[model samples]
Target: MKRNICWIVLLLVLAGCSSPPPIPYEAPTLSFTLNLPDYADESVKNSELQDALVQRGLVLDRFGRIVPLDEGSCLYPIATRTALLKELEQYQSSSFGYTLVSLKKQGDDYFFFPNDSRSQTLESLTLSFDSVLFDLTSIDKGTLVRDWTTHFAYLDQTLLVTGEQHKLLKKKHLSFALRNILIVTGQRASTVGELSMQFVDAIDTTRFLVLTHGDVLRSCQALTQGTMISTPTEPYSRESIKSQVKLVSLLPADADFNQLKQQQSLLSTGRYLTYRGDIATLIDRCSAGQGQSNQALCHSKADDSSARKKKVIVFGGKHGA
Candidate 1:
């Protein structure tokens, strides 16, 4: 049953450990743990716990820690073990502070290498996350190895870690969060005469890379497209995403349609992703070019989504070594 404010207040008053953890830092980790109030009685703890468990798709671990088990919304934990055990796998997911990040996985660890728009190849800057370090095989239903997505799934307030407790997370190179990031988006057309979306990485203005879905315009039409951008999954609200990512449109609100068609944009010139390497490249089954069309723009009406029309498999587009 959902707990009302009164009940929550009552629990806080009655519980031995009422203080909740600090808001979690936005980073990938082994897994996120839920904070449970130590009620004065087992009956109260058990009753209030169910609401958090089902809402966040969490289960109690042997340690009495609430964790995501068989969570469909977040597959980071089981995505690896369930896939045919390939020697190499790629994980593409939205990051906190970053628009999108892809960690290359070989065996058991995933890694992140921060690079600029000029990144020609994907490299590892830090070992971001890996599930193998934890031996969950002994825990009941904890058989699947876990990663950082569990805590970030829905901005679960119960997962925040404050005080010295933040040190508990094993996230490496925490300074990487301080890196400057830029959000770039542009238009690309498709073979079907549809203006399917694609990403543009401006090597000049861009200090580091991140993608905004459309830079959507009247001339833009994303029939069915997917790219590594600042788009969110179903569990996220635009407000929540906006809080962490900063997006700027290459095409301004007062952009001239004719000038855009003539290869002009707010960048004061055209910026295109003409890379043959890996990082943030496009699998864009789309033809390259831009110009706004009222008809085409209104069809899909401009969205910052990973995939337009449908949310299918979106790769990080990490090409070569």
Candidate 2:
């Protein structure tokens, strides 16, 4: 009797339950535009700088998307990476004082001699950090490596001699310190593995170096470049840099036109990437040489837009190194 009563209740409950609504499906459409900063363009020309950028995976299409273009069939990723690195170099140099200390393009990997001795000092500091802090490996291997080092050094006289005042330094300088760690370590990491792997290796290596180096006067050529150029006085704005980087190309990634258009709606929105200078000079130069529409002025349109289009202007932040 109890079993029968339970079955009747279950049937009533089952009959009362309603079916769920179907999920709506929309096509996955990609839509975004990206550009290279001025320095990234220049760095692409330098084989060494290009390698550094490739290692970091910063070289992407106009949409800020990375697509490995290793084969000869596709060179857009290669070109985009090279160009973006060149453009980024300006900001790196101006903001952080990175100079072309030395650049040499090896076979697939480029060997860079940044001329900054922070690596040496970091090597030493890593040793010191190892000495003072116990069980630091937990944080050392983790993302906190950079943060801990900056905090530890600022609190302790790790970077300065015993007599020097550590309290005077603000924590803000830690970011710069962290940047130095990345550059030095990232350069070293670029040597052992593929481009992307190398970038990570460099970062990992920097953690060890930052921990080991105690207080040493490292080479400041990179830093000096910033000072000489008065980069700090002008200061590089991250937002402005991001904006300028967004303007390099309409379709900056590694994809066919259809693929790129599918990824970026602006490409289909009737936008083109053109250099203002190129457009301004195209008419005069074309009239003097070739008057055909299919000739000089034709290529002058930025990417695909006409010269008269209202443009988003970007200012060069600084000129360091």
Candidate 3:
């Protein structure tokens, strides 16, 4: 009986020494919806906007009832992860101060380099939408063991970001803007990962010339349909087609006066303005680039007021300028 007790004790000790099984990882799927108010104009509201969306095959729920647009805006959930990510990527790239970091997914893990020593596992990164806090504890240490190049990893899961969640994202975006850091997040194998990069070595700037009304007319006359620059306008009569014209801010490129003049001459034949600033500054100004009332506010901090009056043509790439 004493011998049997010793053997049982030994077995219990061995069992206690063994590591516990890892928590079952449930891959997360992120869902998103379109903010109807963001797409709505004065004329397109309530049932009218719903009907238009329905015509476009964006009916909501099962009953085919129109998605309400009240309380800020209503969102229509997007089905494909690819399309949702693409739109989110575009918004991040276009928004001032925010930049998307490239991530590599191998099997059930996603990885990205920190590019800065300050960033670490879950301490420096977080992904939250609305009240839901995603699980990031499933980090793969093999990424660190195999190579020190990858700074972080997360188990694959799907992440859903509804329109309500977007408000939270915008708040986080504002936080990033204030901190002067690049925060990027993506949904992968049932998981969402957020990475912050502290250092950026390069950014590329691309330029486009804004053509004036006369310049547009002149170009239309000389250029063929294929080469002509078309400007979209709102309709006053008949069926209204979507307008291609979009408002964007222009920043002057880092070039000599002569080069700027030469490019202006080549691209435009009418009066125009030049903008020269970083991405963050440009976005801050352009957010207010609507209505006559906001025009003054947009131009309040301009380097030159004369240039602010002219229409803007957006220029510059996302990173490395």
Candidate 4:
């Protein structure tokens, strides 16, 4: 997040005695002052009007971190209005805008409208406690979407989004999104994840895939404590192999391999499989067992080693590892 010291300085400049003088008061437990006047929207001062800004997580301090309390919300600086407007204009250079029309929120159910119009909605559809804001919509309703104008400093205007409904807004997706914005703003891919080790390459926004494993995993781990990311790699392959390929031995203890079997059946019927989605086939292909007892053992150390060698030769070492 970018910091604008101008807000603090502007507050100092404006601090002084009024005609009748102001009532003295201590700072609130939670407080924030806005740094940009033009964008802060003075109309927000109305006591009776309620804005979705807070619920949507739009409240921010000059430092760009979310302000948790009402007292922390402040107006953008009046002095910097011109500069703020200029920045906003630059941010709004693109003609496209997005309107997110969400379905009514129940206890925890979430839903979004599938529309071909420029507008789209993000629903909070969670099926289980582990589900993170998952939802679904028909693909035909997808339309062209762009980054939020209010978040320009954190993203770029050139970053385009394909119309698709997704359940998990995983950190990898957010990181890639940030990288696209930074690339458009001419900044180095701001290092993502807690440790800030994984750097995204901003060549084409559309071509950039999210980082879910390896360095990406390290980055996410660094950012938040007790966060575990899925790291199953290359589970399926279409190419016939003369040698074997390595599979991750450390599977999640509670992982639903049964759920995987269901997906595998779907893949066999017609669904596409990423390398991570082909676990059963990859294991079967790399093993030598024919009987139930032999298959229970799954593979031998020698087979595992051969598979690693084949993977290094076929998919290249960087990702195969």
- The deviation in Å at residue 92 for candidate 3 is 12
- Score residue 139 of candidate 3 by CA lDDT: 31
True-vs-predicted CA distance for residue 9, candidate 1, Å: 70
Mind giving the per-residue lDDT tens digits that candidate 4 earns over 1-321?
A: 124688776666677432445555433343333232222333444211112222221222322222222321211100011112232233232111111112322233323333433212231111111111111121221221122222222422223222231112232243334443212122323343222222222343443222222222222223332123222222233331211111122122112222334444443433422222333322332234435554443334323433322222232223111
Collision count for each candidate, in order:
6, 44, 28, 18
Deviation from native of the Cα of residue 37 in model 4, angstroms: 37
Ranking by lDDT: 3, 4, 2, 1
* Lowest lDDT 10-residue stretch of candidate 2: 212-221
Each model's TM-score?
A: 0.17, 0.18, 0.18, 0.17
Give one digit per residue, the lDDT tens place, for model 2 in 1-321: 999999999998887685455555534433333333333333343433233223322333332332221212121101111112333333332211111122222332212223332222333334433212111222222233334444344432212111111112233333324222222223433111111212211222322222111100011111122121100001122222222222222222221212233323333333322111011111122123534552333344323332121234444343333
The CA lDDT of each predicted structure is: 0.26, 0.26, 0.27, 0.26
lDDT of 1: 0.26
| lDDT at 234, model 3 | 17
